[model samples]
Target: MSKTLTITDNRTGKQYEIPIEHGAIRAMDLRQIKTNADDFGLKTYDPALMNTANCVSRITDIDGDRGVLLYRGYPIEQLAENSDFLETAYLLLSGELPTTAQLNKWKTNVTLHSMLHENVKKFMEGFRYDAHPMGIFLSTVGALSTFYPDAKDIFDEQSRLTQTVRLIAKVPSIAAYAFRHSQGLPYIPPDNELSFTGNFLNMLFRMAELKYEPNPVLERALDVLFILHADHEQNCSTTAMRTIG
Candidate 1:
């Protein structure tokens, strides 16, 4: 006998039943078996420390020589070509492609919270006129810990969500502010109407005296750039996430 998996489409409010044969189910059950059998009998001397990369979820498996990188199982190239950074982020956290409605709701939540507090802005102004942008950026993010000590709550889902939203929304804003500051110009506010890359371009180049026309070819290229840069497993920054925890 075979079994079926039932799934519902949240956006359209529809349901589906996918049939699975017994042989297919058996294959799936077998795939879950750990292939590295030697570790089964090994004894650990340090109980507090992980013996062999206990942090599997955080590190993405990439066969770079094969041009494949996956967060869990979702393909990076597909995500880069077909999705935006925010939606890709949701995929990273939830382990599934979000429905169109889910994507819209998620984007709206992030866009609405993009602006930083006035006190943070004021603190940024105290940096020396010639300070490097990266220094300012690191210090500003560290300062966030002081403002919301609860940001350290890694295990709390809501806190993690809040911090994720804040980071995604504010990173470009802070970057743009640094560029303008280097030129002795005032910081520009973000335009909620623009997409992530679009807003970054606007913040960096848009001005009252000039009209900025974004080229579609360039926009697509920039989107590709962000997607390519979006995530890499166990890179320096990702490794930092593990260390911080």
Candidate 2:
């Protein structure tokens, strides 16, 4: 015979009745019941920091105790060794690896949109030498809405695609510029021939006197770092997005 399970949320005061297989009832257990606040260290509990309830991106899962991170169910170690940043981003956003054809198409799309507008570059030049890079990045991203207001049409797949491409392309440039500005150096244009991570490293470290070539081991390690930082559900930023939305 089939069984039914009922669950209620105290916060929302909502109840759900779910049908289950006959033996599924055996999975229900409520033996551990303790009310003393001391047992759970109530003093250490901070409601402001507790944010596991919100849900957002399906990018990565983090297990703090085990020191493990999985991106779209793929282990971080595997992705770092075998994958690139763009591939990992695609996996996080789309939930799977792109087929060869899809990858080619995606790469082409991103490459085509990599160039930032001249006006935006002029705006960057207006910032003071002492300005923080993160401030510049945030302001520049918000400025994108003004330059391409059509991106606000989030329901359009093409618009979303364009925005995604623009962000992926320009972020490295922005970061490199921020690095250079700290040293009072001019910004460098991106080199299209190189891979995403390779291009970023080149932009940051390339000197007029020396040809920059990224170390493969370092590139792979950086790829792993990006993968590990990709996403965590209900994280601070994710929670802020939820609250804002």
Candidate 3:
């Protein structure tokens, strides 16, 4: 049997029943609360939304009490043990693991788009020598909107996919560029021969005389870290991004 929540107003003894929907996780239906004073005759205050359930999501779930986390219904431990970052990313975005051909296509597209626009490099030059890398990352991402105007029309499925790939592919380059700028090092172009994390490592640490090599153990460790931190339930940045979108 499904559960329902009953809310009663003390002022007029009015009652409202909200149905509960169960998925891989559980969430209470609250779409009925359309307005603050009009619907409930009062406002709820939750500074920073510290204890609020503002929306429902099907992506990931965290059980802090049990120290358990699941991504797309797959346990984090299993994914860390057996899956790579791209596989984990595909699962998070598409709700399923991709077939071999699909994964190859996805990886090819991501690798092909790893290089940023020439104008993006010029934009990096404008940042002050001591500018914080995080600030630069934020501004560079915002600038991506201008570079790809199609991103504005997300209603188009193809445009949305293109922008999504561009973001996933280009962010490592952008972040690496920011770090290089801070250190007064010339930017290192992404290596097509390398995997995603390998390319990022090359861009960040490779030098004119010495090439960077990714260690298998370290690379896998970083992959697990990325997969684990991919998304959590409405942290500060994720909540802000959702609110803005």
Clashing pairs in 1: none
**lDDT for each residue of candidate 2 in 61-101, tens digit (9 for 90 to 100):** 77889988888788888887787778878887789999889
The per-candidate count of clashes, in order, stands at 0, 0, 0
- Give stretches of model 3 more than 4 Å off: 6-10, 13-18, 22-45, 241-245
Rank the models by lDDT, top first.
3, 2, 1
Q: Output the number of the TM-score-best candidate.
A: 3
Q: Which regions of candidate 2 fall more than 4 Å away from where they truly are? A: 1-46, 49-52, 56-58
Looking at candidate 2, what is the lDDT of residue 188?
74
Best by lDDT: 3
lDDT score of residue 70 within candidate 2: 84
Query: Each candidate: what lDDT?
Result: 0.72, 0.72, 0.82
Tens digits of per-residue lDDT for model 3, 1-245: 65776767665576777666542212223434444556643445667756656578788889999999998889999988888788888888899989999999999999999998999999988999999999999999999999888899979989988988898999999999999999999999988888888888889888865667887777777788887887775678777887576
After the best TM-score superposition of candidate 2, give how far the Cα of residue 235 lies from its true spot, in angstroms. Answer: 3.4
Model 1 alpha-carbon miss at residue 149, Å:
3.2
Stronger candidate by TM-score (2 vs 3)? 3
lDDT of 1 by residue, 110-223 (tens): 888778778888888999989998888888888877777889899999998898888888888888887777778877787887887777787777767444555667767887
What's each prediction's TM-score? 0.72, 0.76, 0.85
Q: Provide the lowest-lDDT 10-residue window in model 3.
A: 22-31
Error of 2 at 59 (Å): 3.5
